[model samples]
Target: MAMFVHLTSAANAPGVRRSGIRAASHGQGSARGVYCFPVLPSYTLTHQWLRELARFGSRGGLVAVHVRLDDAQEVLVGRYAERARMAQVVVSAAEAVRRIAALEDPRGWEVFVPRAIRPREVHRVRTAPQVTGWRYLPDAHGARPCTCFGCRVRGGYGARRLRERLPHPLDGPPPPVRVLLAQVAAGDPGDAAALREALHWFSMRRRGPLDRLAGLATHPDPGVREDLVWAVAGWSTPGVTELLDGLADDPDADVREAVEAARDPIS
Candidate 1:
């Protein structure tokens, strides 16, 4: 599977690079090894990144910055960009001015950076449609708060920071699919984390039960689908192969990426 990042002046540049996404994280990436790549864009792009990040229990967000870009900069992406695990955009100087003027979101914040950082790597700025992240498994911590790396870092204020409040996330891995789905539907802020844990747990089950859960791929929740896609990525089962192949055109872009990322290089 190819890990791609979008690069440009403001990280939205037209430069698309095929590179491996490093798993190194300043904080607990997730109980499930959810990783994130900085991407470019405000609305549509942010959701895609967050959803992808959320699947692995890693958290991501978008922040808007005012910056100038070279003429060759890009403002949009093709299918590959949509399939990217991480994407960035660099609007040309002209496009930046136009977007800034045409901006419709009243709450967008401006980030003032030092002169050195501002001009050098404007693409590295972390932008978000919203901010959210989940921590390690809850059971491992042995506390109601699950004081694992995840809870300690973000103080559970990640996805919760969005205007649409989430109830909270799950506490630990579930033994099966129904319980997993219920935990997800509960709408916990840690829902993503729980999904990660469940993914980790499900991968070890016997073939019979594991295949049963795979059939639930039709689940409507994007969160569940995100979790499902990443959960089955590395498994060696006939059903898993078909499950990924069938998701090629999933309505959700992130789901499709998960499927693509799960494919074996030689397959």
Candidate 2:
């Protein structure tokens, strides 16, 4: 049998003891399973997922549930990111341990059993240090965080504070609407860039003095009109619907396409 450790909330200890570890899908895929790491020699490595799992606001503290599976049992093994891409390789339980143990740095590596673990397979549950292992990513301590919209989920724990501390260059907060309008009116060589930036900002915040920008609908630049479509697409303002209707027939093919995309973003 190959030994592995699964980290989970201490609050679920009673249930786990009663019914083993239930298999569940992480996201929208067929990769439903219990995620565990091999029982490595290093105690720290064996419970490396403790801190990261805590970040998800697991009820109470965390515990390491030791489990044993047949060496011939099939499992998926890969780095956390590779699993999302369905790039994990199918391997025997014993091979999974051997591969990860041989790696010099197996911080984000994981083994996934595609079904629920039975109570007989569970060896024991023990307390794990809540602070053990890394958060965010392995070795991410003291490193500058990427504050891009995709990387930093809005309203997440410490998300706002982290962005405020280390804001990205292009993804940082935009200038005031008045400041953006001034740059647009100047009509300098940089006006197009400024206008595009302003539109991008407005897209995220649909509540703005959009009337001031109504004139841009016919602005000589077709790109500006296309961007304006995107900016007001989600707004429920009185005239926004009419504005989008008019832009739908724009002479420029790109502007028409933008209107379509804005109306049905899923496509």
In model 1, the runs with Cα more than 4 Å from the true position are 1-197, 203-208, 264-267
* Top of the candidates by TM-score: 2
Reference-based lDDT, each prediction? 0.39, 0.80
Measured over all alpha carbons after superposition, the RMSD of each candidate to the real structure, in angstroms, is: 14.9, 11.4
Query: Looking at candidate 2, what is the lDDT of residue 162?
Result: 89
TM-score of each: 0.31, 0.60
Residues 1-267 of candidate 2: C-alpha lDDT, one tens digit per residue? 999999887777887889998776653165557889999999988888887777644556778899999999999999998966889999999999999999999999999999989999999998888878977789887887788744565457897788889988877687777887776677633477778878877765546667877878887788889999988876767789889999999999879877865653311
TM-score of 2: 0.60
**lDDT, candidate 1, residue 55?**
31
**Model 2: ten consecutive residues of lowest lDDT:** 258-267
lDDT (Cα) of model 1: 0.39
